[model samples]
Target: MPRSTHRAAPTPPGGLSRRTPDAAVPLRPLGRLHDVASALTALLASDLKEHGLTAPAFHILAVLRRAGPDHRLTTGRLAAIDMVTCSGMTVRADKLEKSGLVVRERDENDRRVVHLRLTERGLRLTDRVLAGLHAREARLTAGFDADELRALAGLADRLERALQHSAGAFRPVPPPH
Candidate 1:
């Protein structure tokens, strides 16, 4: 080759691709956390799929079930609690309504506001799914002793708090034109 225009990207100490020069410093631990989270998500997703639910749908159902006897919440409030956009909530509500698991009702006082209420069928399904999920979770964590579990929970809590506190410090990079 007379002259090569291609240059291979440099690999960091652990042979991992570096997004930024400083990324290597935090990559390993964070990578492990991501891996564990992905595995847990897969496990949970499979369980949900068996019950004819996806993760988002399950989350909505769980939130409503937790809201007490009436099993009702304003769409805006549900969207906020679920950390999803109102439009996204609307889409989910549409699917749920079609499934006969939920219903939307205009607010009596304010016609502009809408509420989502779980149906009796939804309530029963949620209860059954939750029971199965809890048992699965217990089995998954059975290997961990109480002290280890506590320590892990404490560390995860700290990480969550730190991430929340520093949320504004990070920004998404724009794609190249």
Candidate 2:
């Protein structure tokens, strides 16, 4: 009798193993992206804490500071941007006001309407926070060239837009007054 030989089958070009469960087929890339985002968020959260600001507070301050002094967003709008309830927005505004970082002004025509503005102290703090974050981001991306960064950013943008098209995508909620 002639000698018999046997060989194992090879995985395909994309590395999708035949042994993997059907449910995990498309989760690898998405899961990896989530992990990367979580890591970056943790780094940012630590930086924010070191500056005596929570992530939400820092985000709200940055948004207001970025808006020019002439025009301020209404509290409702801020709540929407923050994706929090109206009452939640008030709590944030209260904390910021106590810190002298933000001010609430009532509309002359409509006393019911209120707008949030950043104070000089808030502006200065936001600037410092931004600088630290930029430095941190630079450190994180030190290995990547501009082209690679752009490509990654482009991918993120596309993914974000696609997610937004879905009904379950998060939309900012108005804060409680």
Candidate 3:
């Protein structure tokens, strides 16, 4: 007889496969969550394109705008908040500085550190962009009633916390320094 190539699914001691019917149910919502996230990201990118800003650059401006009336943050802090490398933040800062959107100032007490402060032009632009994004988001959720929106937001927050907890298990070990 010819050798058989098919393999059977592995079953646990309880005689149930790891990929049980219950396991599949949770995945449907996860798939929908992915689609929603992707659509929102695309909308943001499209809006940013109209203002000649990449997502990261927009994020940098937004962070500074939220900092305070002075709209300042350290370059390193911006990198950490955006989860980008220092060099990457530097590149974004350089572009913003050249465009008159941000100014880089040396820390008074710590000469080694640099702070990025948004200029008047930068603040105005960030405000405009944020307003537009908020308006569009509101329109996107117009179909949902106030209570429904509140419930959805609460559920989303819970899902985010749950995912963060689960992600801890799969975090990769850091490379040796």
Name model 1 segments beyond 4 Å from true: 1-27, 169-177
Clashing pairs in 1: none
What tens digits encode model 3's per-residue C-alpha lDDT throughout 1-177?
554444335543433333543342223566667666987999999999999999989888988888877789888888888778999999999999998999999999999999999999999999999999999988999999999999999998788677668947433322211
Range of the 10 consecutive residues with the lowest summed lDDT in candidate 2: 18-27
Tens digit per residue, CA lDDT, model 1, 38-136 = 878998899889988899998888888888788888888888876789999999999999989899999999999998999999999999999998898
Give candidates' CA RMSD values in order: 8.1, 7.9, 8.7
**CA lDDT of 54 in candidate 1?**
94
Clashing pairs in 2: 85-175, 85-176, 86-175, 86-176, 87-176
Cα lDDT of model 2 by residue, 1-177, tens digit: 543343334434453434433322333677667667887899889988988899999988877876666436688888888878999999999998999988899988999999988887888889999999999889989999999999999998888778877898745333333
Q: Model 3 — which ten-residue stretch has the worst lDDT?
A: 168-177
| Alpha-carbon shift of residue 50 in model 2 (angstroms) | 1.0
**How much lDDT does candidate 2 score?**
0.78
C-alpha TM-scores of all predictions:
0.76, 0.78, 0.78
Off by over 4 Å in 3: 1-27, 169-177
lDDT of each: 0.81, 0.78, 0.81
Error of 2 at 48 (Å): 0.8
